[model samples]
Target: MLLAGAAVAAIEILHRRYDGAVARGTLLDPSARRDRTDLDGTLNYLLVGSDRRPGESGPDQRSDTILLVHVPAGTKRAYLISVPRDLLVSIPPAPNGYGGGSDKINSAYEHGGGGEAGVRLLSATLARLTGLRFDGAALVDFAGLRQVVDLLGGIRMCVDTPVRSIHTGRLFEPGCQQMDGTRALDYVRQRYDLPDGDYGRQRHQQQLLRAMLDRAGETNLRDDPVRLDRLIRAVGASLTVDTNGVPLQDLALTLRGLPPDGLTGVQIPSHPETIDEVSYVVLDDGGDQLFAAVRGTRVPGWVTANPRWVTRL
Candidate 1:
């Protein structure tokens, strides 16, 4: 049943429109002129959650959520490493020929024009930071996330403590419960009220992801074509992939056998510090070790040794 949901999700992604340059270069090195086989090594995908709304425009448009998904060669397991948007890093010059400096990592996206150029700059920045090249890039609008959760009949999540959304003023009680689209969006967007701040929000985001996977396992998407179609349309409208030209179906097949337990979520190690009176997350030495493990495709070993870095979700 989970496989069917995965297939349905893949089909929806394939049917959706995508950018041309996302998958244009070598899988191991996006800047490489030559193409590389996806089967040869681990695949790294940069997933960005854009906070901008439809038709919204401004310099404030940034990736509120950034994750590097590492899929090992055999596709037996996958690792998701979350990069805080507030992480201070050096941004490369934008394709539009403006803006470059040490700032929040997400600044690259905003300065690069919020499209392919933004993705390129951000991907380059990530490559520089992690020493891992991207195989592909995916962008999901916040609006789409809400629709996807709602379409899946509201994902189930456990609130360890009462959560009052900083954005929406919505309150979530402590317990396992189903959340509608609006409620779910509010649930993941709150950070200020939590003790862990942004880290707590990150955990909620990861929890939402896990809930989606669990829902997929419980629901046979194929059995109800109508619901499946709605889901596909909702997802298609919200998600965009830069596959370069790799056939979407093939990529889907590569991921078909992935089990729920195979997915692991880890937070990039960082410490909070103020730079020139502005706050930022500075990657610690452990972060270097984590990225090295990712680049070496030895995340399982890294996780075993540094268990604290792994998110319990």
Candidate 2:
């Protein structure tokens, strides 16, 4: 799970209890997603992590991370599904009627005008690709990640492999350790040296989110008024979400009550392939089976059969 998508879940808990502390947006197009008529009662939220850096000027042209938060009909558990940004797909045209063709999935942002428009087009592309409808979407950045993690007094992350940050040269040994915001950002961005490369980074990203959710579960914010206020404010500003016209408070209420540790993270089965000298991810036949299971709200069954594909989050 990307920080932005994790922010969606975190904000859901905060908004449910605190009543209104998160920023909201109109980021989805009602007509863009698939009609929910044929599929099971599954709710999907598109969490997009924009590639804009801390000092970069101008709009984000690529999505560094893309995740789908899937809540099955009973809402007993949620799945964090990672979509590789380099996956090749046919992008749909923007609302303004410009730019649509076979391209990397991350390029949808630039092709769709780079803000809320980018989110809508990305959602549309995913909907067409997965035959899934999005109930909501969110755009989250890394700067807010620093604020919230620091505000919470940092998070505990267990690194599975030794990673040296490419950005800061900070060595993260293979063990569970407490990490501040800046270190967490740098750690999550170290993909090049990992064993599974980007897939390993995705797993690290997913674990960071689970840690945030877990740490937040441990804190009793109401007991500390000052921290509570600052934390709420930080969380509220970190996310820009569209609940597809559903009230944020109501959706939060509906989303609460799942076990704090019940999040399941999975990556679609794919392999890196070079097409015309350009790298792209091509999903295997198992991805089709996984999508079929998701469509029927039977991912548990899919997981049981394809256990290797499920990341232990």
Candidate 3:
């Protein structure tokens, strides 16, 4: 009887696993995502990551990553806001009863513990600067990102130049190739290969991200049980969300409403500029124009009514 009971439990677990996988794919409706019809309307999320290693021993600690996503309902258009990590900004007082002062926009995560603090600081900062209200925030570490690629069995990307820079101690060549967990991270994090330094690295990272998403659509992970389990575990382990904000189901629903290709990449404007006697990537005049378009209710005609940026490859 005990042996039979163990068998039953194992079967139940497997059943639940497959059930969740199917739900993640089929449960998503591509037409129902939109701002709430009642009260305050649509939702947007500020997805941010920090160079500051959370609970990890690392000398590198600061804000060096940001991605703002806008999701509206029943539309194919989604806006991706990529804010440069080095953008100079005033960091507000710590939300955890601790005080705060001015710091880079990315350091908000490190100053406050990880979840609410980071999200609050960013939401406040963006509202003051760009007039966009965030519904919630989610944070993912490099490991989580790596696992995501691995689950898809690696992503294929074309390297425009010979990527021979030593970053995090890995070297890659230029060409069309497939990247696993380690190589993907290395590709996204390298700065020495590009002449523009961090700004170039950010552009490469965004490209890598888009490539990964493209590859995912062609892969079996969306229907494969083992892969889905591993991917979810990795994401669940590394991701933290503000519970007082957008629920996962609601967020997923919003994501489902938008056709993947309709989303266009939006990077914060920055050209080289001197700040406090140090060279930094400062927002150009086009920066305000870009953010204004993002803050507006309608998607720009350039993005919504055109397919100019589509990757034909």
In model 1, state the lDDT of residue 295. 76
| Ranked candidates, highest TM-score first | 2, 1, 3
How many steric clashes does model 3 contain?
5
- Residues 18-100, candidate 2, lDDT per residue (tens digit)? 54666676677665554442223578788987766554434446777888888887667888989887888888878677668
Per-residue lDDT of 274 in model 3: 72
Give the lDDT ranking, best first: 2, 1, 3
Best by lDDT: 2
Each prediction's RMSD to truth: 5.4, 7.0, 7.1
Over 4 Å off in model 2, which ranges?
Answer: 1-21, 34-41, 53-60
The digit string of per-residue lDDT tens for model 1 on 44-110 reads 7888888889877565688788888889888988887888888999887765886678889988788
Candidate 3 C-alpha lDDT tens digits along 1-313 = 9999999999788656533432111110112122332213545666655554447624234445677776555456666767777676666565475476655666655565544445555656666667665555565566557777887788886676666658565567778888897787777777767666766666666676677768766777756877777877766655656423344555565465455466666666666667677655667766776666666755465354434322222
Higher-scoring candidate on TM-score, 2 or 3 = 2
Q: Could you tell me every candidate's TM-score relative to the true structure?
A: 0.88, 0.88, 0.75
For candidate 1, give the lDDT of residue 13. 68
